[model samples]
Target: MTDTPSPLTYAPPALAAREDLLAAVRFDAAGLVACIAQQHDTGEVLMMAWMNREAVAETLATGRVCYYSRSRKGLWRKGETSGQLQHLVELRLDCDGDTLLALVDQLGVACHTGRRNCFYRAIRDDALTTIADPLMDPAALYGDAHKGHSHG
Candidate 1:
């Protein structure tokens, strides 16, 4: 009933030119794009972060995932302090090119709260419930220097 090509037999459209990867993305007014990091193998969503042009470029060049931190107002290289790094496996752009999905190999906990991922809380029975427990103590991960500040 539809003319759409089957996913099994679908082929990617040819690019008009070999354009720069950054040029294909549409950033926000703050020159930032939303990026979702997911477990490469298990398909578990790790965390969400913002990426600027510089972050994207650096990630591609170094094969390391980098994010722009609005709180720090600088580039936040994942696992720089917590030892929980996210290695880049594949970077995918949405159809609108406004969001990016980074398939990654997470080294350790992906949350500042010491959980496996950032999505620990879920709404249950009309109340916010804590689902996942911290894998490691926050102090152990960041030490006293980063006491109050969030890791993400």
Candidate 2:
């Protein structure tokens, strides 16, 4: 006997209106937007990064994350240096359509200093408190800090 199909089955949209979404955002002359990376599960603000047009496209296309590195003046793939990669979950735009919020599934730590999030320091009574410790050594990720610095 042939079995009947389930009624709960659903299909995806015909096509994602990615371009329309992009057009809604306001990018600067650098073709970049201020992207805020947030932890999906915890709602914790991990870090703030920049995303150029190419970086935004790459992040959405690959599902792996991408950012515009101001210091490098190029694209930056998270975890390439520190192994603290962020996997894109969802991308959100603020009500004003100016800012971007990236909901991500992060691996290992998020901060370069090895902390779970970059916002480890909290201000209490006008005093800063080290609420969290580094998960990995900074030197292991970015090399020696005392060395010559280069800006992008």
TM-scores for all candidates: the values are 0.85, 0.80
Question: Which candidate number has the best lDDT?
Answer: 1
Rate residue 99 of model 1 by lDDT. 98
Compared with the true structure, all predictions reach lDDT values of 0.81, 0.74
Span of ten consecutive residues with least summed lDDT in model 2:
4-13
Q: For candidate 2, lDDT tens digit of each residue in 1-152?
A: 64322212212212365566677888888787898988777788888888888887777676667888887789888887667788877777888777889878888877776688878888988999999998887777678741432212
lDDT of 1 by residue, 1-152 (tens): 53332223323233332135688999999999999999877889999999999998777666678999888889999988889888877677899999999878889899988999999999999999999999999898889846665633
Candidate 1 ranges with C-alpha deviation above 4 Å: 1-19
For residue 42, give model 1's deviation from the true position in Å: 0.4
For TM-score, the strongest prediction is 1
